[model samples]
Target chain A: MADPAYRAAGEGALRIEPLGELAAIFDRRSQQTHLVTQPMPEILAALAAGPCDATTLAARLADSFDLDGEGDAAAILAERLDELAAMGLVEPV
Target chain B: MSTIRTLVDLLAGRRDAAALAPREWDGVIAVARAEALLATLAHRLSGAALPQPVAQLLGDARAAAAVATAQAMWEAEMARRALGPAGVHFVLLKGAAYAAADLPCAPGRQIGDLDILVARDALPAAEAALLAAGWEWVKEDAYDDAYYRDHMHELPPLIHKLRDRMIDVHHTIIPPTARPNPDAASMLDRAIMLPNGYRVLHPFDRMIHCAAHLFADGDLAGGLRNLWDFHCLTRDFQARGDCDSGTPDGALGYDEWLGDMGYRAKLWGLGPAVRRALHLSAALFGDEADYRRLSLGDRLFRARLLARDDWGRETRPLLRLAFYIRSHWLRMPPLMLARHLWTKWRKGRGAAR
Candidate 1:
């Protein structure tokens, strides 16, 4: 419950296309296209390597995204991962 | 009404969605819903310009379609697992088949029932396997069940207790008692295996099946969507060069292959249906170069296809009733149809009493 590990589906499961500002991700796993705005896309991209817990995923994401947020970055990213899992784009490991 | 036509034009990519006024958009939505093609129209108009409400509605429809498609595929997977132990390998049919094969008609296609075809000999086994896997009989009436078993091509419909989704196990495409019967065993023999451990009819069989379903088995209900499927599938086949033997006819080589491979022996007497299917598709969706003339009956059939009004309701009551009678007529001989209707009417009267 604290920092659940999550795994994005294997390659070719999600077809990510950039649409101007919002990114359109066609999740072949779910066959649902989601128009996402921010760190959600980055989180799934980071998880593409393999399954990892929230803190580790946050660390992986920090290389590209600044993790200096008022609310904890790991905490926020964990919520986004939960959201993605709800959408069936990522699975809770 | 013109609303259905607008919806079709939008789907055929002839009419511009952006140019539609707000009032016309409402009618488009209504007619699309009536024809059970909202998701398909949504996919057709996706990412294109749209009114705010229309876009929102279509976006929701797109999401619903995704869920429907996933659920459909899952049902197929479950059926596969269930039938595997029973030694019955089922071939996915219609929308399920299209989605599994990722056909051009698949995107945002609304799938209701999960249809599969097994060998006629395997009907009992397939029904047993499905029942064992939580699929329960939908009709408890003895007459209904017996009628389906005896006269229909498919087993009486079964619904999974948990999923609430229905499945139709078919041995053939149309009823045995119907006017035009297709050869199902040959289709099963020619079925192609997908990587996902499922099977679909061969491309040619799929086309023939669609045409047969539209022109032979059914009345003109939902004809537009079926015709669109025919159009898209034909275009997809052409794009993939399934018929690119540089034939002088400039028609699809598969059309000739329908002869060359001697599929004619199995096509029964469906030659006119296939011809009419192609003519209707070309007339509706093709450009001027591809246009084909329609017969007087074909014109009326087109009217039946577009008989919905602006409020998502069927408008032509008399025409609808006529087609309903015609469907039953085509489904059975005069004597059998009379008996079937009389029994049904007696039951209705008893219930009313």
Candidate 2:
């Protein structure tokens, strides 16, 4: 098994949290990460309510206006979740 | 006559790849892009336009982005100390160099750290230098460290103190215990130095190194990726054919077993990609048959060894004890195993406070 923190979910989804002080959360879904911005706190909160997939999270990306179009919604959420997982804020349930 | 069409055919038909599941779509995309960039780089380096099929097969954006990151990091690290006479020679090994030179495969396809081979005499100082520079030892277990130092050829792993980047520093590509320990020192001695004094393993040794790394190493978990590495490297070797162009030595040429690797990939059902890759790279890579014949037993051995992880706790200790016995027994004669066991027992008793 891979390190538990980077486990895979069903098809097209991944559960990621950071293992430690690594900045930038990883998106298990996209297997990438997004650098955090001030608007990220709001974005992350919206994601916490449920097990949202990449397409859903992209539609809810309200704070990425300064950035262009959806701005890697899948990659951003996954990376944030990875960071949160590393911090023990989120988990694959 | 139809190079691009052939590649598209290979990619399109191999859609049922068991290992290429969509859960790893991101990794897949990353690998595709990396392969595309590699094709471009090889074209530039060899001064020949890469065939259309090769370019199309590699053009995935995700894999390319990761390769771009790794390449940038590698270049920055090399450039930072490029001019100084700090006696630091950074030679990229395994996937990075292979991808840079040949192979339409992406570097990110095999997700792992960058492996660099330094001279053996410089091993200790190099380790110290990197440690001081910010890479921390990720594996702290003494037994594991001893295993790498004594039995293997390099350090375990080191992760960047700040960035999440990781690197594996090495003195040799193949372990000393594997087979008739190929003449590593001689290979290094003949290694060609690129501009900036950075050295790469002599072509023959580099090919053999890839073979040794994939087959001889104990890491079976990455078997699929390892096979992919072998396949890609073989293809790249065929392309340049410049490294070992004049060598009369049988072992120092790529002719020995490049075909064998291709045959083995097919035999193990690694899909037609291996065969296609061999043809695409013009048989510059592994010989499928030779590689297959040599590695069959080792692959079986690794599969069994890996299954030890799935055993229940009741059987786990027995397995561990068996490994302890086997590892010691084969490494030495009967007397040595007894002697070693006695020493271990005595040490355990002493620590039983």
TM-score of each: 0.76, 0.47
Estimate, for each residue in B1-353, the C-alpha lDDT of model 1 and write its tens digit.
37887887788898888988888988888888877889999999899999888899999999989887997886786687578878998899999999988888899887779999999999889988888778999979999999999999999999988667899999999889987778898889878887767889877677788888887887878888888888887777766644322333235465575464235524576777777777778777776423336788877677787788888888888988888888888889999999999999999999999
Tell me the spans in candidate 1 whose CA falls farther than 4 Å from its real position.
Answer: A1-93, B242-266, B289-292
Estimate the lDDT of model 1.
0.81
lDDT values, one for every candidate: 0.81, 0.48
Which residue pairs clash in candidate 1? none
Q: After superposition, how far is residue B11 of candidate 2 from its true place, in Å?
A: 5.7
**Residue B73 in candidate 2, Cα distance off native in Å:** 4.5
DockQ, all models: 0.13, 0.02
Q: What local lDDT score does residue B20 receive in model 1, on the 0 to 100 scale? A: 85
Report the error of model 1 at residue A10, Å: 9.3
| Highest TM-score scorer | 1
Taking all chains together, the TM-score of candidate 2 against the true structure is 0.47
Off by over 4 Å in 2: A1-93, B1-85, B106-108, B139-141, B194-198, B243-353
